[model samples]
Target: MSDKFTLDKRLAAESVFAAALPLCDVRLMREQRWFWLLLVPRVKGAAEIFDLSAAQRAQSMEEINFAAKGLQRAAPCDKINIGALGNIVRQLHIHIIARIKGDAGWPGPVWGRGARQDLPPAGQAARLTAIQAALAAGVGGDMGPKLSNLLP
Candidate 1:
């Protein structure tokens, strides 16, 4: 495995960078039907959660919870769904989605439900800003220089 971390091409194409956490690179999914975030560990060749060290796994869970809370604050929902299904992506990334009743894919998984509705440029910017702001405010101290700069 290479020491340097590189994001998967498919993930890069489908999401926008939101912030760089200590253990993960936070990204916002392009789908507009629900508020979704991807927490991708910066470890190269880490295809599954087990690939990470014990400390890394703990950090990943913390980051997941952090991102889920930020998502909830940004987009209030009835339920928050989290998953790490890598059947296709093969990347060590956790998905955190805010789900509401009667949404486009209600009572079912969001994957393969229908064609993804990509957010418009303006909507993307607005959602990213909301998420960044929510995360920044939720954290006690500065989220480091990288994350602070990403905040609006």
Candidate 2:
């Protein structure tokens, strides 16, 4: 329900997956080392979550909770970390990441903690397919689009 807000100017340049809800936009992280959904409330002209009214804030939290549930079902992760770091994107987005103990960069924070291993073409395709299936079934809809499919 952020119908009154406007889209940010920088949104045009970001890597988008799909619009998951009325006020929620889901996008895949550029690096495919793991599955991470960047969910941002589509509030135009707002630099941060604090800029939203109380109602929008509550709604965003609800959407984020639902998105987290969706991610947990799709990823089947041991631990999930949710964060909204605006240092880089500055778009007031929240990241929900599925993590396992033995995953790449284990026992360490994913941000600037270790090098990311790029997913191979076949592996990436398979992972993406699995994630899509899980999201479709678990989340009751597709997590997002396959932006990688157009990279040929």
Candidate 3:
């Protein structure tokens, strides 16, 4: 992460703020029902994972898996969907989604399937607490650079 890094605007618009991980910014998508998280590496002008060095890529995967565990603890699901598709937001970022059997997009992809549901303030706060606790419990070594203003 560098002082020059700034999150992509599209990501800022769609995601609910979460913690900053070792190699990425952990975020919760605004859709309420599913546990969808996004991991954006803090590298300016990086549109692909390969843009990062070998060590950075390894660290990013570690952080992604760590976040997956936290997401699982927060909301258990039938499957965990992870991917990095830059068609929309070109910035190098990964999606870590916990999918249940009968979710909104259950048997289909969440993308372009439906509108994003807004979560209640209480629910959002609770989810955030659970995820943060889970990450804290599972993580080892330096937790990485944390942005004071995690929003956007």
TM-score of each: 0.92, 0.71, 0.86
lDDT of 3 by residue, 29-140 (tens): 8678777889999888888989999999998988888888778878888888999999978999899999999888888888887766887777778777777766766543
lDDT of 1 by residue, 90-129 (tens): 9888999999999999989999998989988998999998
Encode model 2's per-residue lDDT on 37-87: one tens digit a residue: 777787766668898889988877876776677678877888888888778
TM-score of candidate 3 against the unseen true structure = 0.86
The models' CA-based lDDT, in order, is 0.88, 0.65, 0.79
Ten contiguous residues with the weakest lDDT in model 1: 138-147
For candidate 2, the lDDT comes to 0.65
Per-candidate alpha-carbon RMSD to the true structure = 2.2, 5.9, 3.8
Off by over 4 Å in 1: 139-152
Candidate 1 lDDT (Cα, whole model)?
Answer: 0.88
Query: Candidates 1 and 2: which is better by lDDT?
Result: 1
Candidate 3 differs from the real structure by a C-alpha RMSD in angstroms, to one decimal, of 3.8
